[model samples]
Target chain A: MLARRVIPCLDVDKGRVVKGTKFVNLTDEGDPAELAERYAREGADEIVFLDITAAHEGRATMLDVVRRTASRAFVPLTVGGGVRSVQEMHDVLRAGADKVSFNTAAVAAPELLTACAERFGSQAVVCAIDARRLPRTDGAGQTWEVVTHGGRRATDLDAVSWALRVVELGAGELLVTSIDRDGTRSGFDTELLASIASRVRVPVIASGGASSPEDFVTAVRDGKADAVLAASIFHRRMHSIASVKAAMAAAGLPVRPVGEAVA
Target chain B: MTGSKPRIAILDYGAANLVSITHGLAAVGADVVVAAEPSALAGADALVVPGVGAAASAMTHLRERGLVEPLRNWVRAGKPCLGICLGFELLFDASDEGDAETLGFLAGRTVALRDAPTLPHIGWNVVRAVRPHPLFDGIPDGSYFYFVHSFAPVPADEGVVVARTDHGRPFVSAVARGSLYGLQFHPEKSSDAGLRLLSNFLRLVAANAETNARAGAALGSEVA
Candidate 1:
C-alpha cells in the first residue's frame, strides 16, 4: 500500500526562505537549502519551494535556490512560482527539481500545460490551483472560484471544473490550496479538498490551514488527499515530522517508519 | 577473484543521466563506469541502461551514436544487464505512447494504461515477486519499489515476468530471463529496499563474470 505523503512548504523570496500570514507581511526564516535539508532529515516525504517574489526580477534566483536545495536534499523537491515557460520548466528540472509547479502562468496560457506534459512528461509538471469559497448567489449554494496572481485576482473559473480540465491537459498532480483557510492555523478545508479530489483522476495534494497533526489525518483520511502540505506548523517547529507520523500511525494511517537517523 | 569488486558498466547513449546512476552504483559499493562507447561495454562484467525523457528521443540518441547493435549483442551474450524505467521499457518490442522503436531485446509491447484510475503511477508501489529469479535473491517477495511512469510493458512471453504489482489491477512490474533483467521502478529513489536490490545485482554480476571467464579458460585448454 502507498503511504500518505507529508510535505513542508517553504516560501522563498530573493532566494531566502520566508513565512507570512495569509501571504502578506513576509519575514525571513533561514537559508532555503539548510531548512530543506532539515526537513528531509526529519522524514518529510517531499519539500515544496514556492518562489513568492514578483515576476519582474525573473525566476533566476528561484532556479539557483532549487539547485542549492537539490544538492543537499535527497527527497523529491517541487519548485513553483514564476514558472512561465517550457525553458524555465526545463531549467528547474535540470537544476534537480523532481517537479515544477505552475499557478498564474498555467492559467494564463492553458496550452503551456500540454506543451510541458509533452516535453517533460506529465509526472514532472504539477498544476497548482488556489481557490476560495465565494458568497452564495442562489441564496443557498456557495461557489468555489479560482484565484490567480498569488490569490489577488478571482477568475470566473470554477475550481472543481478547472481541476478536471487541467487533468485532461495532462497535469499529473493537483496541488489545491484554500485561500480562505490559508495561514489560519485552524485546519484544512476538507469539504473543498474532497470536492476536487472526488472529481479528478490524478493525485490531489491538499494545502492550507494544516495547523496540527489531526488536520493532516483529516486531510488524508476524510478528505482523501494523496498528500498534505503545511507551512507554519513546520516552519516554527510547533511539531516535528516524527511526532506527526507517530500521530498518523496511532490514527491507523499507513506511514513509512522513520529509519535510523543518518549523520 | 572471490573478494574482487564487481565491474558494472552504465551504458551512456549521450542523453541518459550517467552521473546520478554512477553515484547510486558507487554508493552501493559497485565499481561502475559510464560506458559511452560500444567497446567499453564488452569489458564490463554487467551492464546498466539508465535513462530519462521520451522513449523515441532516447532511441534516436542511441542509434545516432551507433550503440544499438552493440547493446543488442551484449544482451544476447547473456551477461547480467538491468534497465531502469524508460531503460526497462525500451528493452521491449515498442512503445505506443510515441510509436517509439525499442531494442526488442525482450518479447513485449509497452503500452499506455488508458481509462484506468490514474495517469502517472508516481510514488511507492510494492514489487511482489511472482516468479523466482536470481536478481530477486535476498529481496523479499512484497518489497516496495518507487515507480513513476504512464506506460508499462505487456510481455509477449509471460514466462519472463518475475513480479507483478497492482495499480488499477495487477500488472507486470518486473521481468527477468536468465541474466537479463528490467525493472519498471527507480531503485535509486526507493531507499533501503532499492539499495538491497542493487547489492544483489552486483553479486549476480560478479558470479556471472566468473562463470564466463571459467568457460573461456576451459575452451582455451581444449583448443591447446
Candidate 2:
C-alpha cells in the first residue's frame, strides 16, 4: 500500500527554474530553490531538477542548486541532465540529492550505469530515457525509438528493449519520457507506457505528457507505472499535488493522504 | 538521566544513510545520535542500524569498526534495536549480493527477488501482519510501507516472521524476535505509517528499560 508518487519536474537553466513549451521557447518561472521549497511544502512526493544548461555549459550548476534546495526541501530530490562522470554523480549526492539521474552519459558509455550503480547503490542511480514513436519501416509495424541529447538524436535502440538492458545494468528505476506527447497536455501514452512496464521489473516513472490528474491515474492504473512526472500541468499552476492525490484516491488508486495522520 | 529523554544511538557503520535516518528519528522526538564508536553504543537505551550498498562491503565496514560483536552483544542483552532496508538484510546469515557471509544474528538467508512480479520492489506496497509483534502495535493490518530492494531475507523459523507482503507471492516484509526487529521498508520514507512504527518502537524501548530496572532491583534485594 505504498502511495503512488506525484512528481513535479523543474527545468533549470542558469540556476533558475524555466518551463518550455514543446521543449523550446523557454520562459523563466522563478528561483530554483524557491520553487522546490514551494513544491515540497505543497506535498510533492519528490522533486526532479533537470540541468538543461549542463550540456551547453559543459559543467553542472545543478549540484549547488541541489545543495541549497536539499537544505530546506525535506523531501527526496533527484538531479539529472549532464551527469557524465562518476565524479559528477558523487558531487550531486554529496550535495544532498537523494538520487542522481543520467541521460546522455548513460547512453554514450553504457558501462557508466554499472559503474555508478556499483559505487553508489542502485537506488541512487536513475536512467532517463527520452523516446519518440517512429513509423513502421519493415512494412506493417510501428515502434518507439530511444532518443538522446534532449530528444534530438534518434538511435536505432528500441525503447522497451533498452529499458530491460539498463535494468540489467543495475538501474533502480526507469524515467521514460515520450517526446511525441511531451508538453502536449493530452495525457500519457497509455499503450506505450503499459508496453514498457510489462517489459521491465523496475519501477517505471511515466513522463512527457500530463494535463490532468486523470492522466496520472491512468498512468498508474492502466499504464501500471509506479509514478508519473509532469512539468506543464504543475509548472503552470494547472494542478496541485493535493488535488492529484485526491483524484487518484477517487479513482481507487491507493495514495498517501495529505498531513500526518497515522493509519 | 532518569525521567529524562531516553538517548537513542544510531550505529553508523560507514555505509548507511545516517542523515535521513537521524532526521526522521528527531522528527518523532527521539534523542538521536549517529554513533560511530563502539563506546557510544554502551549508554544507549535503544539502537538503530540504517544501511545501504552491498552486503560484503557493509560487513567489511562493520568489522573494521569493531561493531559486529558489540551489536550482537547489545541485542543479546535485550536492548531494543531496529534495522531498516540494508540494515534488515545485514541481520541475516548470508546474502546473495557480493559475498555470502552476513552478521548471522538472525536465522535467514537473503535472496534476490529475481522471479518476483517486480524487481527492486520500489514505491509502496501494503504489508500484512502475520504475527503479533510490538512493532506493529496500533497500526492496522494492511498498512503500507515504503520499500526499495531487490533482495529480502526469508527467515528459517516461520514464527520469527511477523509480516508478509505480496509482490508476486507473499514474502516476508518484517521480522521480530525478542528485542531485535527489522523492517525491509524505509520507514523514514514511509510517511505516517512509518512514524507510527517509530512511535511503537520508542514504546518498546521504554518498556525494556522498565524491565531492566526491575531485574536490577530484584538482584540487589537477593544480595541483601
Candidate 1 versus the native: TM-score?
A: 0.86
Worst ten-residue run, lDDT, model 1 chain B?
B14-23
The residue pairs in collision within model 2 are A1-B125, A1-B126, A2-B124, A2-B125
Candidate 1 per-residue C-alpha lDDT over B94-114 given as tens digits, one digit per residue, 9 for 90 to 100 = 998689979999987889865
Model 2 residue B196 distance off true place after TM-score fit, in angstroms: 2.6
lDDT of 2 by residue, A1-263 (tens): 45688889999887888877645788898888899878866777778998888455535466667767765565677888878788877777766676788877888889999998887788888999998998878765557899998778988898888988998997889998988888777889877788889888778899988988888999999889988998878888889989998999999987756554455
Using all chains and alpha carbons, the TM-scores for the candidates as numbered come to: 0.86, 0.86
List of clashing residue pairs for candidate 1 = none
lDDT of 2 at A205: 91
Off by over 4 Å in 2: A1-4, A12-45, A53-76, A94-96, A138-140, A246-260, B1-3, B213-224
Interface RMSD of each: 4.1, 3.3
Q: Model 1, residue A109: displacement in angstroms? A: 1.8
Scoring only the A-chain of each prediction against the true A-chain gives TM-scores of: 0.95, 0.94
Candidate 1, residues A1-263, lDDT tens digits: the string is 66677889999888888888756788888999899878877878778998888765757788777777765555677888888888878778767677889898888999999998878788888999999998878766556899997678988999988999998997999999999888788899888899988887788999988888999999988888888898889989999888888888899986755553211
